[model samples]
Structures are given as C-alpha cells and as structure tokens.
Target: MNRMNWYVVYTKPKWEKKVAEKLNEIGIECYCPIITQIKQWSDRKKKVEIPLFNSYVFVKLPDMDRNSVFQVSGVVRYLFWLGKAAIVRNEEITAIKENLSNTNISDVCILPYKKGDKIKLETGVFSSQDAVVQEVTNTHYILVLESLGCLLKIKYKKDTL
Candidate 1:
C-alpha cells in the first residue's frame, strides 16, 4: 500500500456514488464525500444527497497501478503524474470529515453575491485585479475582466477561502 491508502479516481460526472459502491461491492475500499443539496420542483422539493466534487471519487487500493483502477466501471482515470499514480493527501479526508461532522449539512450555505458588480480578486492568480461579476448566486462567484478575459470563479467564506 505504501502510504497510498487513498487515491483519486476521475469518474463520470454525477456518478461518484455509483463508482464508490461498485468498488465497495467487490471488497475495494472507497470514500465518496456526500453533501446535502436542496432540489426544487414545481410539484415538490426535497433535499438530495450529492457528491461535493463532481467527476471525482476516492478509492483505497493496495497498489498504485493506474490501469488496474482505471479499468473499473465508471472510472475515467486515476490522478497521476509522469505515468505514476498520485496519492491523495490525508488532510483531504480530514477536511471532508470536518465538513460532514461539524457543519449543518441540511442547510445549504449561500455566499452573499449577485451578478454584474465590480469585484476585487483577493487571492489566486488574478489577485489585485479588478473584475466584473458575471454571476453570483450562492457559494461561488464568477468574475471577469478584459485584462484577463477569462472566467474566474471562486468559493467564498468570511474567515477562509
């Protein structure tokens, strides 16, 4: 295993749980971060469980062979570099634990924002640049500027990015 208890597997968009379940059914360990999302319908609304990051799922395998894991159903690929499998950091799992255990998952938190406003890039590559808000409705905001001319989306939190 060699410090590779956790590895990343790129999966079909919105198929995170299916892959995790498939892997688990065959005795392979896996973890898919589940988050709560409220779905609205004309007739009814409900809170549905969803994966936090789309197209990403985690697996625990005894080896770092990329092909072995990639062959699994719904798996597009494994995170790798220079033809070698990359290990997922332990902290990533820890962060997920905190989010699930410490926060109120039923209530989806919204970041205060709206479309078409002047914004300042506080961090990342475009930091210190003035940007125009293209879309802001919840926890994420999309920014744009002619100088960069590319969409810059960011997640917001008052105390942390």
Candidate 2:
C-alpha cells in the first residue's frame, strides 16, 4: 500500500482556501497557510487573513487518492516538478505552519536577487541611489552602495527597493 505523502496543489486564482476546505470536507487532509494582516483604507483599518502562498495548498494523501483530490472544486491541478507531482516533505509543512503561526511576519515580500546584481533603491531616504547586492535574506537585503562607501541592510517589500 502506498503511504500518505504531502503534495502541492495549484488552485484557481484566489482559491487556495476554498480548495483546501473542499478537500478536507471529503476526508482528504489539507493545509492552507494563512497570514493575518492589518488592511487600511482611507477611514478605517481592519484585520484580514489571506493565504500565505497565493494559489497553492498542501494535501496529505496516499498516492492512489490523487484523482479524488483533483475532482474538488477550485483545484486546477497538482503542482508538477520535473513532470511529476511535487511532493512536499513533512518537515517543510511543519516549518511553514510554525513560521506563520509563531513569527511576526509583517508585510514583507521576498524579492529575488543575485550576489552581484545591481539594485537601485526606489524608496526611503536612499531613493534613487544605486547599490550592488552583497547578500540576500528572506526578510532583507545587504547592499553595498559604492558612492557612499558603506553597506546598508534593510527589509523591503517587492519593487520598493
């Protein structure tokens, strides 16, 4: 018998929660990591919960039950890596849950950068300054500004720095 394993599923846009719920209702174990954030409008602010990884949910099931998961509404397909369903290790799922529940992860979005990439500061007091990426982290980037002869490390949202 095939043992149960965690697999990643892709859902329709904005359907991560829906797909996970439907899968659970049918007895399939599923996880959809959600993050709470404070959303502000012109007048008032409210707390909102959104999927941490947009359009993705994790399902735990035997390999033989893959078809049943696909039949759920809002589930587009399994996330494929190298032509097969992408398997997520149990440790990864646990880490994701722990990270979301235990961390104060504010409105931080990770931006991809390489060690030698030239990045321009687009916000803050350093706006318009050009720097070379020294190191990249999940929450911030270490940049070296050639003109200023100093290194700057800061947490930034995507496209803002």
**What's each prediction's TM-score?**
0.58, 0.68
Kindly list the per-residue Cα lDDT of model 2 for residues 20-106, writing each as its tens digit.
888989999999878777899999999988886668788999998898887798988888766778887775566456545533334
* Model 1 clash tally, residue pairs: 0
Which number leads on TM-score? 2
Looking at candidate 2, what is the lDDT of residue 141? 54
Error of 2 at 149 (Å): 35
Model 1 lDDT tens row, 1-161: 25446777889887899888888887777888776667999999998898765676777766744456555689998766446665655554554555455433333232333346677768744455566767765565555522212344445554443
Clashing pairs in 2: none
What's the CA error at residue 126 for candidate 2, in Å? Answer: 32
What's the count of clashing pairs in each model shown?
A: 0, 0
User: Worst lDDT window (10 residues) for model 2?
Assistant: 145-154
**Could you tell me the C-alpha RMSD of candidate 2 in Å?**
11.0
C-alpha local distance difference test of each model: 0.62, 0.70
RMSD values, in order shown: 8.9, 11.0
C-alpha displacement of 47 in model 2, angstroms? 1.0
How far in Å is the alpha carbon of 42 misplaced in model 2? Answer: 1.9
Model 1, global lDDT:
0.62
